[model samples]
Target: MGYKLNIHDPQDPTSLPPSTRSRLASGRRASESIRVGIPLDYNIATLQPSVRNAWIRTLKALHANGHTLHPVRLPATQRALSAYYVLAPAEASSNLAKYDGVRFGSRAEGIDGTPESVLFAKTRGQGFGPEVQRRILLGAFSLSAQAIDNYFIQAQKVRRLVQQDFDKVFAKQNPLLDDIAETEGTGDKVDVLLCPTAPSTAPLLSKVEAQDPIQAYMNDVFTVPASLAGLPAISVPVPSATEDQNIENEEYTPFAGVGIQIIGQYGDDKLVLDYAKELQAVARDS
Candidate 1:
């Protein structure tokens, strides 16, 4: 039998605890779900309502097939959003610091002009976004001799643990593992693991931007695990049936659709894609 796991609340309470509810209310959780399987083929510029429907139809076809959908949730997935932002920019700051003139890239044209100090300030301020600037400052502080062990080093450990959580659930072992099977299990060990691509369907682009940076960051919580583990995964859209049909409004949509992602072992790209094709076919027939 395929292994099954549920990352949702155990009690099935009508409402979540305040902290959890707040995250959910903010759309952080929903964003985390949808981005998992954004089609590589999707191009924002040319996206049309009809194309979205076509994608949904394809997903519906896949579900009609015999493929079983297993919902896998790792509570740690939520925490990962915080960890990734902390670690990614911490690393980016260090990596990007080399761009400083004299030691790295081209020096400013007005090095000796009036005030050298003001010139350097202008160059950096003009080059970076507020988010980028904040991260760079934070990263620089984290790397300071006094803070290295406390912040940077600890963040690295969290990153590893985050990766471990993913290795635990995926149907296949990470190929990067020294012993593939020993690290978790084999490819044939499980057919596939399934979960919401995002907590909800696509949000308006404006709404998406107005959300908190952390909330926007959560968009990748589900997908990032697969990426961090270097596994192959695909998102297939699952559209809800219409009103005249028996399906509920939440279950099907004419304007939007759900996405289910399929992840495979490192070298099993072909298998994953094949399964995705099968799923698309099933959704169409259904």
Candidate 2:
């Protein structure tokens, strides 16, 4: 509901490269930049410096395009990431449990009725991928009587906190509370949140494959908070400043595909797409 446009002379802003976005915090023109909110507690340090610089350039480009940067922070990232690891696997375990040979899926022909348990085992063991199997085990353990309250139940509570964090940031006015008194949410509400799509730029396929299963999950750290809250988030790929600047990393070339995630408040699907389109168009024109 809060959308406005301003006209400014093209020559007024500095012609800095996209890479200067990080330094824009200290720049005099920063006051005129878009007020974008990056989430709080995200593991930004884990990202490679080049990747971080890539983000710097992208944000600076946006700033040059006449957007203001706002310091906004969403506080549920760590908790949501924790809850997601538990909850997603738990649901996957339950949902995949139905595929146990007899009721569903292909059955082993060699042993039919006598060794029913082995049949189920063989079917599942051969059917599901390694990661899926790992999740199933984790989920089963989490859902067990002793661990359920400690893991699954606590994860649910964290999920609610994740939702509340988003709602508060979006300045969601509760309909029920409105009858009693003004339940106006946060005073400084941003139209959308701009963040990194992943912790870093796209990693090499071979390097990604070599990562430990749990380590691979860390890629979703920045994403889980918004995802858990069921908000509409779009990862719009932007051209990297170092498109050909290959860093001397241990393995593989530098990631040239830099992605920026734009998230809208819950149910604001159109707003997310529209802004993404605008950003893409601007990038293309530039």
Query: Candidate 1, residues 1-286: lDDT per residue as tens digits?
Result: 8754323465777333444433321112211112122223222342333334544554344344433333344455555556666666787788877666546655655642245363355556656778889888888888889988987787667767756766665544554566443643342334444444554566666676677876666566657656655566899876544532333333233566667677664555656676666666666565
- TM for candidate 1 is 0.60
lDDT of 1 at 154: 76
The lDDT of model 1 is 0.55
Say which candidate scores most in lDDT.
2
Give Cα distance to truth, residue 105, candidate 2, Å.
1.3
- lDDT for residue 167 in candidate 2, whole number 0-100: 60
